[model samples]
Target: MRVLVVEDDQFHASYLQDTLAEALPEVTEIFHASDGAEGEEEARQGGIEAVVMDLQMDRRNGIEAARTIWAERPQSRILFWSNYADEAYLRGIARIVPEDSAYGYVLKTASRDRLRLALRAVLVEGQIMVDREIHRLQKQGAAPRNRLDDSEFGVLLDLALGLPDKLIAERRGMSLRTVQNRLLSLYDKLGVTVDPEDEAVSLNKRVRALNRALVTRTINVETLEAAQRDLDAWLGGRG
Candidate 1:
C-alpha cells in the first residue's frame, strides 16, 4: 500500500513516516509533503492508498487541503491528526467523505496503537473511526456539534422523516413527558430555549434552529448531508 504524510513539522512528520515504515514495512511507497499545499498536490497525484494529515499548518490548513483532496480523489482514504479537533472542521470532513471503510479522525496526541488501528481500519475495512474523546466532546455540545439522546434521536428522526413529535410519541410507545423531556434537553443544548413547556413545541423550535444554523454555514450542509447519506446508505442496504 502507498501512503502520504502531510505535516508542517518535519520531525513529527518524519516520526510518522518512520513508524509506518517499521510496522507496515510492506507498504511499498511512502510520500512526504511539507505543508497542506504540497500535500494537496501530492495527494492529487497517482493512486494513493491512504493519507495521514495534520489538521493545522502554516501554509494551507489541513481542512482546505482535505476538501481539495476530497474533490479530487473521493476514494482515497483520509486520516486526520490534530492536537485539537475543531467541530466545524470535523463536520466538514464528515460531509464529503463517506464513513466506514475510507475515512478517520484522531488527535495528534493519539497513541501509536490507536493510529495503527485507524490506518488499518481505513485500509482494510474502509471504515472511519472518530476519536472517542472527540465523540464525547461533541456529544456534550461543548463544540459546535449537535448532541442527541436515544429519545431525542428518535424525535429528530421523526422530524427528518416529516412526522410530528406528538405523533411520534404515539407511534413509538413513548410518553408525552418522555418526549417533552427529550425536547427540553435538545433546546438547552441548542441554546434556544424558550418556555420549554411543550416538548412538541420545543422540537419544532429545535428543528428550526438547527435548520437556520445549517443554512447559515454555522452548522454546515456537507457534514449533515454526509451523515444523513451514511445512515440512509447503511440502513437501505440492511432493509
Candidate 2:
C-alpha cells in the first residue's frame, strides 16, 4: 500500500508515518506533506492508495485537500485522522467521497493498533472504523461542558471507561459520595437541563446505535460533514 499523509504538526506527522511503517510493513512507501496545500499538490500527482490527513492545516486545510484529492483520484481511499469532533473536521470530510465506499475516519488518539486496523479494513476490507471514543461519548451523550480539572476529567473518563464509582474512588482517592457529586456536575455541564428519566432507555438506544455502527462498519457521515463545516467557520473567525 502506498500511503499519503498530510498534517501540519511536525511531531504528529512524523509519529503517524512511523506508526504506519512499523505496524503496516506491507506498505511499500509513504509520502508525507506538511499541510493541505502541499497535500493537494501531492494528491494531484497521484499513485496514493490511501490518505491519512489532519482535517486542520495552515494554508489549505484537510477538507479542501480531500475535495481536491477526490476530484483527482476517486479510486484512492482516504482514512481521515483528527483529534477533534468539532465542526471544521466534519465539513472537511463532507465534501469528499460519498460514505458508501472505501473511506475511513479515526480519531488522532486512537491506538496504533486501531489505526492499523482502520487502515487495513479500508484498504483491504473496504470498511470504516468509527473511532471508539465516538461510540463511547455518543453512547453516553456529549458532556455538557469540559469543566473537569484533570482529576475530575479523569473521573469522568472513568465513567466513560465503565469503572464503578467505588472502584474509581479507591483508585483515585476520592470518597464515593465525592465521586458521585462530581459526576452530577459533569452531567450538568454535559447539558442535561432535565433529569434523566430513563437510563435504561437511553443506554439501550446508545448500545444499539453504536453496535449497529460498528458491525455495519459505518457512521453518521452526514452529521460529521455538517459539524466539520461549522467548526471550520468558527476556526476561520466567522463565528
Candidate 3:
C-alpha cells in the first residue's frame, strides 16, 4: 500500500514511516510532507492510497489539507495523530469528512500497538477509529446542553464580534428575543454567572462567555479567523 505521512516534525515523520514499515509489511512505499500546504500538494499528485497526518501545522492546518485532499480523492483514508483532542479539531474534522468515510483520530500519547491497530483499521479495514481519550473528550464536550447549539454559538460569535442583539438577530435570522435567550443560554453553559449584588455595575456576561470559551478552547483563534473570513466574504458580497 502507498501511504503519505504529513507531519511538520522531521523526527516524528521518520518514526512514523519506520513504524508503518514494521507494522504493515504491505505498505511498500511511504511519502512524506513537512507541512499541510506541502501535504496538500503531495496529495494532489495522486496515487496515495492512505494518509497519516498531524493535526496542527504551521501554514495550513491538517483540517485544511485533509479537506482539499478529500475533495480531490474522497476514497483516500486518513489517520490523524495529534497531541491534542481540541474541540476545534474535532469540529473541523467533522465538517470535512465524507459520509461513511474511513478515518481515525488517535493521540500521540497512544501506545504503539494502539496506533498500529488504528492505522490498520483505517487503511486496511476501512473503519473509523477514535482514540479512547479523544472519545471521552468528545463526549464530555458534547454532554453539556448549553455547550452552545449552532444558534447559541451564532449569537455568541456575533456578541464576540461586538454586535448588538438587534444586529445579531438580523444577521442570524432570529428574533431579538430568541437571540437574547440564546445568548443567555450560552452564558449559562460557559459558566458566566451574573452578580445580582452588582446590578448597578453588572458584568457583561456575553464578554465573559467569549473569554471563557477562548481560555477553555471551546472556541479558538481558528474559529475567529474562519468567522472573520466569512464576515469579510459576506460584506464583499453586499458591496
Candidate 4:
C-alpha cells in the first residue's frame, strides 16, 4: 500500500518513512510532504491509499488537510501522528471526520511497535485506533450533559481569544443574538452559570468559563494559537 507521511519536521518525516519501510512491508511506496498544504496536494494527486498526518503544520493543520482529503475521497484512511492529544485537536478531528471512516491517532512518544500496529490496523485492516490518553480526553470532552457542540466550541474559542460578542458574530457570520445564545450554551457546558448566592463572584461568566476551560484542559496553548490564526485570517479577509 502506498502511504503519505505529512510532517513539518524533515527528520521526523524521514524517520517515519524509514520506520514504515522497516516495520510494515505492506507499505510498498511512501511519499513525504513537509506540511499540510503540500500533503493535501500530494493526496490530491490520487495514488496515496493512506496518510500519516501530523497535527501541527505551517500553512494548514492536519485537521484541515484531513477534512479536505475526506471531502474529496471519503474512503481515504489517515493516521494522525502527533505529540499532543489536546482536546481542541480531538474536537477538530471529531467534527470533520466522515462517518464510519477508518482513522487512527497515535502519539509521537508511542513505541515503534505501537505505531506499527496503529498504521496496520487503520490502513490495512480498516479500523479506528485512538491513543489511550486521547480517548480519555475525548470521553471527558464528550460527557453527555456538558458536551459542547461545534457551534459552542467555536464560540468558546472566540471567547478565549477575548473577542466581544459583536465581533464574534461578524467573524463567524452569525447574528448577534445567535452568538449570545452560543455563549450561554458555552458557559453552561463549562459550568460557569451564575448562582444567586454567588452572584458577585459569578458576574463575569465569560471570564469564569475561560478559566474553567483552562482548568479542564479543553483549551490550551495550541488551541489558542490555532484560534488566533483563524482570527487573523478573518481579519485579513475583512480588510
TM-score of each: 0.59, 0.56, 0.85, 0.72
- Candidate 3 Cα misplacement greater than 4 A, ranges: 138-146, 157-173, 199-202, 230-239
Model 1 quality (TM-score): 0.59
TM-score of 3: 0.85
lDDT of 3 by residue, 111-144 (tens): 8899899989998889988889987876776566
Task: By lDDT, rank the candidates, best first.
Answer: 4, 3, 1, 2
Q: lDDT of model 3 at residue 135?
A: 71
Error of 1 at 126 (Å): 1.8
Tell me how far the alpha carbon of residue 64 in candidate 3 is from the true structure, in angstroms, after superposition: 1.7
**Per-candidate local distance difference test:** 0.68, 0.65, 0.82, 0.85
Where does candidate 1 stray beyond 4 Å?
98-101, 140-239
Q: Residue 118 in candidate 1 has what lDDT?
A: 74
lDDT of 4 by residue, 4-31 (tens): 9999998888889988898778887999
- RMSD to truth, every model: 8.8, 15.3, 2.7, 4.5
Q: In angstroms, give how far residue 182 of model 3 lies from its true place.
A: 1.7
Highest lDDT, which number? Answer: 4
| lDDT over C-alpha atoms for residue 174 of model 1 | 91
